[model samples]
Target: MRKKKVLLVLLLISQFIVLAQDYKFGKVSKEELKEKFYPLDSTADAAYLYKSRRTYYDYVQNMGFQLVTEIHERVKIYTKEGFDMATKAIVYYTPESGEDERVNSIKGYTFNLVGNKIQKEKLSQKSVFREQLNRFRTSKKITMPKIKEGSVIEIKYKLISPYIQSINDFHFQHHIPVKKLEAQVEIPEYFVFNKKTIGYYNVKLIKESKGGRIGDTQYGVNVFKFDEDNIPALKNDEPFVSNISNYRAGMKFELTQMNFISIGGDFKTFSSSWSNVSKQIYKSSSFGGELSKSGYYKDDLEKILTENTTETDKLLAVFQFIKGKVKWNEYYGIYSDKGVRKAYKDRVGNVADINLMLTSMLRSAGLNANPVLVSTRNNGVPVFPTIDGFNYVISMVELTNRGYVLLDATEPYSTPNILPKRTLNWNGRKITKEGNSSWVKLTSSKPAAEDNNLMVTISKDLLVTGLFRTKYFNLSGLTYRKNHNHLTEESVINSLEEKNNLEIEEFKLINENLIGKPVIRNVKFSSDNLVESINGKIYLEPMLFLTQHTNPFKLAGRKFPVDFTTPWKVKNMVSIKIPKGYKVEKLPESIAVGLPENLGVFKFKVKESGGKINTICVLQFNNAIIAPQYYNALKDFYGQIVKKQSEKIVLVKQ
Candidate 1:
């Protein structure tokens, strides 16, 4: 008991010392510049020495409350890689119609040690620039002056906005280590907000209720504060993550309800449930409104669905008709641009304009169809009940006695139940005509498959010439079409030749334009790099250019789930014809490995028959997502795969 008390006292003293350190915007200490590496994470190239943010609502005489946010942060660079840390980009929403956020009072300084003295450089206005991220978002980028290794930089800025409901999400952690962190949020009594937290790291914020005055008006206030030290950086670039920001340590505020206490005690509630949010979005003119208007494409749709006899046939015809009629404009939004009518007339539109039209046509054909609101892979998953949850929309049809099928008209090559990879994030909200909605899985039900067949012949000159044929199915097919459809055959051949360091005799791509069929690619190539001759023996990898030389899973530990996008399989069949005088002396042993709970399996087999070497390698993963608990096992699984594929087939002259 006595030892515990001593330790508690020492911890308190240490915290007090950290709080006593000077953190003023311009008062950078030499101790920060003298630091060569972060103690918490030595691998970190840079670290946040201190960061502070305070957000509150400010009231005016008659203009109502405005959101005010203050930001101040100091960074220490330990290496040349950290020099990029000096440039900061702050993004803000800039809708076309509403009041937009404005940044002001931007100031920064870089402090470095020179001749045992502190030298400071002020940020230049010329280095500050602004650019539009999208139609509704803008970024203000600032580059600190005199940034180099062993330098400390500090920045202070204030953001003001009239949209109180648009409270910016606050992140307590970053890609670099943080030595000190402080954050506070103050809300008035008239407003109520619900907070959602994400990521594995958690920080407790103290909450308190108090009273404050706003120009002769006494109002209740709620304040949340967090102060901490030594926060390790989060590794963001984990393999197969849909969006790392979704797994970042941060907090988001959603306005649940609001009341004007002084004005007759009137109140209003935002989306309190997913059902309520869905109903609100469904009734909007932009989404459901567009679905109801189909006069523009009525004739074209009818002509296409006229010859179809079955419901499935009609559905497929309508989907294909929409894709051919309307092309995507490279934009993503749940709301229609103008309307489905205008989009059809123009022959181009955003995601909503295309998919909503398909839904309308399906419904008109007496089929049960609805629009599924999706937050694409890049937008992250929508975990809360808010109107801003989804950024894309797709069509879903349910037959009388069969399971539903998802369709995306925005993708020209998409087929029923096989959506483009961009829409395969997690789940989407499907809203019906009855104003009801339900969550539907957005990931593909079918697996992405790749089948490769190689026939190889070795020359006495140590050159490898072969015929390679590969086929892609389901998601694999869609990926191939999306990646190479825009490139010419010559460009495609050149790209393949350059990547593999080989000379191509002939290249053929088949079924690329067939929507639902597998895409087949066959190439005839010769390469001397595929085999290595040590002394009088020949050695080559089993898969040749197809071998995975490096493991994609490299993290020592991972908190995020491993997302494969979809269940997948790869099958390889290779037949190697040995040289006339060569005899097989060695072959990699056959092995089979399976992941826990049948998540994945790999089978590698090789045999010699009639002077020809035959190898069959099959790898299949059953699940699109594996929990973080299985990360180590997944890493080990991939490690074994890499090791096996890299094993050489040795042959020598008899």
Candidate 2:
């Protein structure tokens, strides 16, 4: 009887231990949880972990977990001259315990020269642990099984070379579904989150614990769900937790705050180091090989100067060559096998590769040219001298007589004096011959382009006819040129004609040269009975230009600084020869408006000479960037120009 009684007690203890390890579902009583827990929200039927409490536990307890990662890499040898390569990476995670620990075990395996082709491979694994006395204190580990149904893993690599090179020819093949598949994308404020890539499909749930002294029952996953397609499968080799729906439901998330979990994947390659890769298969490989090359000065001198060349001729020649030879690809990368030689041969490359080629060619021609690295406006302003801050480059060449001329070969319509839009980054760094770099002011100088022309005639139908021509130079010219190539003349004419409800009878482009001068556009069109007729009188608008003077800012207040780098001077001439049976009754009142320090100016004048009414209008902006404090003044300046330009001339029929 005594032995049986002891056996029964041992059995009861074992049963209690087993029950503690098993998952349990129970509701907390009001009395038991009175102070310890509270309702999640007024609409929630049950209590949950509060955000403040969850954050506290995440920092104190969950962040204390330990993680161990191992990586094994093997590279194969191919040739005597190898490829240039390097790897950069970053790791981020949320800690599950108070003390978070990470151990990285990485090893590199090299290859011998026995094989003509090289192969490379990498193996990686990660193990996570929590500090607990018993298994019940931690969540259970759930491992996925092999698929018994139709399933597949597809991997894709988005490889971008420095120049035009074939990644497929490199023979770089690895296991499907490379790890960390999601790209660190830049999401502007106006855009929306769209889709997910194939790499996000491997995510697995890891843990699920109820909200407690450490916080609400937190759920952990092996991979992050990005878009709708990131839903995980149950039959994968990796382990996962299944309570993702619940975790997502509890947290309010936005596209900006979204992040991913760290999961290890296997990769294999034959090449051990990038320096040892072969370049025979590549079309052009520079920096990785030995070659004699001149800097930007030599190239510029050879192309811009000759025995009989003048300062203006040399400048114009250099500008024309840069604009005509190279094409813009718009990509940004530092490592490309298709260096300057290949880019020049192909006549096309990304911003860096092409601009660098221009710099090199300019040097080869014996011109004083230097590479100016700049951050594109869309790429954001650079806050420091970090190498990764610049995404674009332009060439600045010093003239024998004149100052420096900023040249961009990528823009076909840009003059030698005009810089591309991308060069407007806060400031640029000028890379010099001594391997030293310094900040270069990108501000524009005075004496930019200011043009005005007018023609007046009397039609046989006894109606007034006028022609106006306006041309821009410097930064103003650059802006127009940038948008010119995006659409054809017919497209622009059709859009404008429809907008104005007018028929275009004659349209011609007088000039398309974009090397050293502003573009000159001549549009000839007519409208039937444009003037309003009232009591034997006719009135016509003085301004016929489509892009008339208008205010760009109308908001009451602004928090951000206003930036306008280009200055402009516009001239409009309207000549109205009196019709055979009509005479001018009243001319628009002459007006003149000016702002401080030549920031902006406008003028309107009409003169009657030999029965002809000659009207002239001019507007100019002499400053690029305007401060917020001056927004109201600038707005008023433009308003006055628009009002003066819109004035009408009255005529009486005989």
Candidate 3:
């Protein structure tokens, strides 16, 4: 009887331990939450209800015990002005767990407010881990029955959430006055635990005034605050293997003020995760057996070869075919079960799958094509051969006679010769057959082509006839082509006319055949009352309203590099035929200007011959990137050019 009683006590103790080990996140219904926390301001225009429950457990996987979390969230927004508020929110859960059963510990929160101050009314309820939850409740009370115009009203709120988790929520009981006030909210997305985990959130605009700009009043909630120590530290567990620990994994929320607008609402999280281990898992599975798939090639090599005569022609044909046939879905992820061949057959995929297909196809065609990994400008810079840092992929094809061509099919307007601006980072890595990668140059030595020409003629009545020609090559040319393709011809001409305040009579564009080649635009127009008549004399701009002077460099001190990839060269000529009784009374002296080291050059000349005053001006900038150390010299050079361009010529009429 004593032994049986002891066993029963042991069983009861085991049951208690099991119950204590279980952790869960639960959601309270809207009615229940409202009943629990009633609003102090009954006349408030908006109300919100939000609840989240998080549960942690231990599970056995491949190596050992790992932590698993199941978090659930729900939110409701109420407004008296109707449900027009835009609200977007999201939650992510890690699909896998690591060696530790408890992967993360809750952290703290940083809150900021605009248009009003905030105060805490009550502290948060404590948890099992003795984690102190900070709760803020508004301290001010409103007793006034009516709010007067031009009166400053204070807005306040109380915020509570896990310190290790990102919280972006706003609650207000009054309508935001749109006439004289604005508001903004910024929140950090990550919190610190022992190991780094990826997190993301969703943002939504719930209520908005009709016909108002949505984004103008709404911005991202996720604002990243830089921390020097928050960067993941490299751990040397294996030889040459480093692991980064400081990482925030989550989406952010953003809000902006609108024109004379007031907003009242709440932001809530629907889901979340503690870490991001999918990157490595995905790379290993997808690329391992990609080549064996069927229907990988669109057509046999013989058929494709018969369609093209020359190598360049074949290359262009293949490029165009791929661009037209494959659709860009704009999804970016390191892992997907769909193989490259399957994606190619389906006619859609992310950057990695599509660019990898391009590389493979080129290799199959007996060409030297390699997949290059790069971190886009928006994605930050790359961290060398870390492998996990790259988020975008592009292809580089080598030509026997020519050099190399970089291609990104995702960029629709990008031509064969033009590389996208996002890829102009420090460098990229070329993935080779043996799994070895080499550094590749992302900058181009070739400069962008530029040309500017203007011709002006003036009559005795001050009527002006002007002809303008612009030619662009390389980067300059690519930019124009991309922009021009998006707009109609009439819109382009109208824009030019409006900018110059002239009545355009004719406009024409040429050089459409050469992809990524120089683009040329020719425009002719006439305008009356262009010259000012003062004190019985007419003063006319020598270049007939053309911008003859420009400030290319603006930095005070030059310690940074100067960019000259997009160089500039302009030429202007103005011929004013003397009216029957008019002759040149005053002509500005000719001047030549340039940087001391020949960094740039500018020149202006005036001459009177055959009853005509001819004014000529020229300016050229040869560098693409300039250093801060040379900024003063460059600035002075441009200043002189501007003065010369603005010089006026005096004309006397008899």
Top-lDDT structure, candidate number: 1
TM-scores for all candidates: the values are 0.89, 0.53, 0.56
User: lDDT by residue for model 1 over 427-541, one digit each (tens)?
Assistant: 8899998999999987777899999999999999988999999999999999999999999999999999998888999899999999879999999999989999999999998
After superposition, which runs of candidate 1 have C-alpha atoms over 4 Å from their true positions? 1-20, 30-42, 77-80, 83-87, 109-135, 141-153, 214-217, 259-263, 307-309, 488-491, 532-537, 652-654
Clashes of each: 0, 64, 73
Q: How close to the true structure is residue 286 of candidate 3, measured as C-alpha lDDT?
A: 50
Candidate 3 per-residue C-alpha lDDT over 245-349 given as tens digits, one digit per residue, 9 for 90 to 100: 111222222212122223343343222211111222224655424532325575744577677757676666666656665666765443322568667779877
TM-score of 1: 0.89
Estimate candidate 2's alpha-carbon lDDT, on a 0 to 1 scale: 0.45
Q: Which runs of model 2 end up more than 4 angstroms from their true locations?
A: 1-319, 333-337, 446-472, 475-482, 485-489, 499-502, 545-550
lDDT of each: 0.88, 0.45, 0.49
Q: Find the 10 residues in a row with the least total lDDT in model 2.
A: 163-172
Q: Candidate 2 residues 1-654, lDDT tens each?
A: 999999987885454333222111121122212222111112211111110101111123533322222222111111112111112131222134332222232222121212333222221122122233221123211111121111111111122111111111100112111111111122222212222211212333122323222245343322222211112111222112111121121112121122222122222222222111212111123321212254424544554566426555654566567556767765654323255666666877666556656655555555677767676666555332233345566777777777777767777766665676556656776666544556677766643564756565546553434454657666666666667657888897897567654456566555444434666666555555556777777677665443265556566643234555456566767666766688788877999888776677888888788877877777767776555577667678878767776677787877
